[model samples]
Target: MAHPISFLKGVCCGAGLMYFMDPERGRRRRSLLRDQCVHYCHKATRAAEVVRRDAQNRLQGTVAEFRHAFQHDEPADDVLTARVRAKIGRYVSHPSAIDVDASGGRITMFGSVLARELDGLLAAVRSVRGVGEVQSALRVHDDAGATPDLQGGVERRGERYDLMQEYWSPTSRSVLGAAGLGLMATCLGRRTPSSMLLGTLGLMLTSRAMTNLDTFKLLGLGGRRRGINVQTGLVINAPIEKVFELLSDPQNYSRLSDSIESVEDLGDGRYHKTVRLPGGAEAMLSERIVSVQPNELVRWRSEPDSFVPYAGAAWFNKLDDNRTEVQVCMSYNPPGGVFSHLAASAAHMNPKMLMDEVLMRTKQHLEGSQPSREEGGERTGAAASTGGHPAGSEPQGSPRVEGASSPAQAGEPVIHNL
Candidate 1:
């Protein structure tokens, strides 16, 4: 097979040589090919030059525009200060709380401001005409009694009043109870197995209505009354003290968790956190450190007026000289009642998965390794049943908590004591 194939290749090569080496036509054909190559090469070079020139022109235009927008000739200190103040007044809320000082075209802003508002305020002041530089000495809300107006106007107040009234009204509860009784009556008339089940459900609904509980809350089908719990644990190859230091600082949360966009220190153990939601939306939450037990435990609770009320605790247990086990527990009430509960369940937005991801990232960051997927099944099995076991005896598994983002493996830890 090899010999025949080689002979065929040699014959083909000879035939091509005979055709191309035709004395008169071969030379002209070769010359035409060379000329065409040279022509295309020159054309390509000219095209390249044109593209280069166009790119240079575009870069110059961009630089000029940037300079025109950002760079300005210095003006008198008083004039620059006035310009900056005007800018701030136009953009920032509670302008009266801010004090402006100017020296050699540099503007300094001092006062109490909301953490979310500070970045935009500073950027606006710096962009003002005639201002050379801007500095902020702004204290946050907790430091200076500058809490933002989370509640709005008279109409909003009225709506809140109405909602509270509805929640507490005996008449509303009576109506729900009547409907449940009617259903029970229908079930009694039918007297079948399905009818009996329906009657039982109706009786339960009636009991809930009598007790002033919502249907979803009574049935435990949604997180309307009770908050969802999530718990996760991980072992990090870092000292407990070092891990605690990083976890204690609110500012470090944004770096540790992908869901947290930013953490603003509001002073006095309080922080304002901006979190990114599943669908590119964002939410602002206020949290305060409620307890700190050095390298052992840190606990935080959401502010009273937050959109979603939540509490979280991180427990640090030293495993060895350079290894530590971190256990996190979070309980939260999803906003918007049953609808929000359904949404959260559908989106798989549970705290357990979020905490697991956070721990994984923290471990990678401390150990100087690239982040990888969460490994192993949750370790909550025997440890959760032990009822607050010693730190050293806590199992290295995740807890089987309600509202888990993912299905748990068999023997998953269940935490009813969070």
Candidate 2:
């Protein structure tokens, strides 16, 4: 999250670098400007202010002239760049990437920077007046040095999905409760005797547990949808390890996440992640690594009864040209019997949108990572290497993934028990 202001300041610094690096040009330019400033300064104590105002006023006209030249599509001047640079340099604290040349306006920046901040940059430039339109064919690089990580504030998108899910839980619970009451009444009406009632109660308990398990399975599936699950994906232009490094680091919560507070790796790829909710609520999720095949996939599951009933899994796949696709799936059973149902329902409604946020952020993180090709393309699973297969890899287990599937396919179907 590079601040537009900071970038503009950097642009000014870059100008200064160019100035000092070529002192002859700087000195010559300063000598000409110095004479004008001195003559104006002699008139009053506010001479510098007057001179600055005059320079700015003149620059405005020059900028307007450039705009006209562009509108008419006429040949522009090359000296305009130096002239405008010198003029604006005297008034503003720093110069932005809005440098001009005799031909047109030339801006030097990173592609990511342009992608992230071009709108703001353009807005600032437009305010300068005189500038008709920007003629930019600037080539931006993917520089590790220029990638600035902004502080993670509240994740409105994630929180919105979470809140919607939370609200849905109540509605779901009401439906289930009504369904349960109807079931119980029907059983009582049949009156198969006292023994039958006991059996019915036992069946209900088993059924409830199974239902909870079934919910978990849905959350663990890649891009799987349930009543309210929102699924989304993003592409990363870096290695999986690098993406994982940022995702695995709790400190990066401040850098990459909007609302995650902390994530403590609980050994064996299990983790305790605490995320902030909208309206100041906090959710503590206990997640276990249901499956982990480095550079390919990482899946986690957590039951509502254990530390946290909410479960989530992330999968990473490498694509061509150093790009990677990451997907996240999460499901949660709300807390408290009735409230839990509402929450669960809410989780179902927009699982795709929430998951989309995870993927997009992951993409941004990976694309912004240090550029260096890893030694290997993908990591082979230990289970596959050994005489073992993922939990659901066998035909007798869950269905096989079509092709180039990660080990996560095994953990998906089992997410929902009942």
Candidate 3:
């Protein structure tokens, strides 16, 4: 029952060290992380601006309402009539067909409205401020089939809520996320059964509000639609064939990535991996390579019952220079649902951070890693027989990947990142 919370914070400093202290690509990763932080800060600033504006407007509106409540003066006839029309517009199919006449403190409506909407329209018109009495001379219709006023008219949409909609605006999401966090913190601290239930509710609210994912995805219930996503691309200073060889073969992961303790190749493109968890613990995983193309692409998915189910793919494109661009995409089920996923992200144990480390190691291994044959003039007969070639030198007849037909571009969307 070791929870992700227990192992979370201890790994952040260590993860940062490995993430930024690597000999190769360390500077680049640090730069990218800094840019992300700056971008996020800008977004936060914009959101704060919007929130401030909204608060100011709400305050002004509240003040206006209070001031208007004290002094009662009937609006002009045209103004009151316009208000009545506005109030009842959404409840009926044809507001223009309704003629509103307002004089003194009384209002009258004369038009043909749908019979179903007549009651609502009268009610809405009656609710308008500065109106004393309503005089109805409206003709009602069951349908808009032959009525000239209701022809080709449709009812406007009524009041709808942001939370009730399929997609919420960014502002709504932020507000919900903030409220959910507060509720979770307040409820979970009581240490009671009821408090625990409330805390779980708060956690779901926070997760769904922030990620905008279905509950099923966050709970890791659906096939391939289970939550969490990691996607990024980088160019390594190695040829396409060399980079593909290192990435496509699972055996090299242990040496190339700090997160991997070992990868035991089971032949036939299957492997079992021992992964180092946050607090120095380990988790076992079994994955079978689902597809592969020689020096071009590699795709794999975790076997059922694996510690954390995941699927990933990597694409290789040979640049004009000797470098290769590697675009990787991965989705994985969180070990303990979305709560644990968020915890791991806070602890730098998320897939994005791990992939950054792994790709950095790959860059280091492929770039200038081979030993020189003329080091201190200590050359063996085997080195001479190999024509002074480096140990990691290219093999014969490796195709030069120079077109866009094989791999997607860096900015192109790969798999569904959600």
Candidate 4:
């Protein structure tokens, strides 16, 4: 009687009974639950299968890596040198600075190598089979120390291809994703503490595996190197000057989208913005106006100390007299990680999607042919140009996203070229 969990269980049972016994929609709800269970069971069975039989492009490297176990014969000298060089480049930042040579199955590496990298390079070279001996004819420097050869070089173009390092390979994804799905399927709807904990962990792991992002990046804990970009644009039924003026100021953001609560101008080209987050929460960010070119473009970024960091830019293109293409590009470390994005996307809460929505509203507002924008241009068919939307009605036009890198330039780490 005194146990809180017991009380919670009783309450949950009562609620479930009430829910399933409802006269109106209980049957539908029960049927939906049954269908979901069957679906999840099938998924769990597949997850438990470990790896698929067919080789996949993403899994090619992992498959090849395992082949070394069966490889007993030594490769030719040139092939061995290529293998060592390929393997060693990923372990060091400056690979080109190091020279690789192999003769009679022996490797001789000679170049200006970093002192810290020497051990790793040597070990990696020794890992290759058919190597008789290794000779180091290299000048090792403790630090870059103005060393030309050891300075300003990165690992050869293989690290990005190798998902086994900092990134997850297809094999890792298959195993981990299956485990997560299987766990969640088993724990679904269980109210016990351990069950809930496991369910949460399963969800996190599944999201991580599905997104190929580490936990730090998912939580926005500063792993946002070369951030995700959303670039999309659409033509608005308004003059270039009118559209440009509206977007030139941050205050107009709220006018274009209902999701924006408010944007307060705080003088000196800065603003305080309040936006609705996923799940009906709100966040405030301090923003800096990086640059502005009238009737051309505007760029902005969140302050470093702000709780949420983001950068964006909008470009105005004149298309004849009464229409303009508004190209918007937003790049940011997605806050709350990949799962949050998946959820938000399901709910239509994606930021890029919002851009389209707001512009539609802005287009509607402009289509009304506000008196200010119509300086004696006389009567034109407003509804005809904008499609027939009743006056004061909401806009329903869809905005198109570029899906390419953003064009607006932002500060380091976040600013990627278009």
Best by lDDT: 3
Model 1: how far residue 38 lies from native, Å: 70
In model 2, the Cα lDDT at residue 150 comes to 22
Q: After superposition, how far is residue 365 of candidate 1 from its true place, in Å?
A: 1.2
Ranking of predictions according to TM-score: 4, 3, 1, 2
Where's the lowest-lDDT run of ten residues in candidate 3? 381-390
Residues 1-418, model 1: lDDT tens digits: 7699899999999986876677978886577558768976996576456546655776798798788776567778888777777776655566777899999878888877766667778778877777777888987663234255422212111113311532434433445567789889989899999988889878875765544434443334443324545577889999888787766655554344445555666678776665666666666667778899999998877776555666778899999989999988765656543345445544545455456655666676777675343555332211111011011111224221111122221111121211
* Residues 199-235 of candidate 2: C-alpha lDDT, one tens digit per residue: 5664453334324333333233322222222234567
Could you say which candidate leads in TM-score?
4
RMSD of each: 33.6, 30.1, 13.6, 11.0
RMSD of 3: 13.6
Off by over 4 Å in 4: 1-74, 153-166, 189-197, 220-231, 235-254, 264-269, 276-282, 289-299, 313-347, 359-418
State the displacement of the C-alpha of residue 277, model 1, in Å, after optimal TM-score superposition.
2.3
Residue-pair clashes per prediction, in order, are: 6, 33, 0, 4
Model 3 score (lDDT): 0.64
Determine which window of 10 residues in candidate 1 has minimal summed lDDT: 381-390
In model 1, residue pairs whose N, Cα or C atoms come closer than 3 Å (at least 3 residues apart or on different chains), thus clashing, are 378-398, 379-397, 379-398, 380-397, 380-413, 400-413
Residue pairs in steric clash, candidate 4? Answer: 218-337, 231-402, 232-401, 232-402
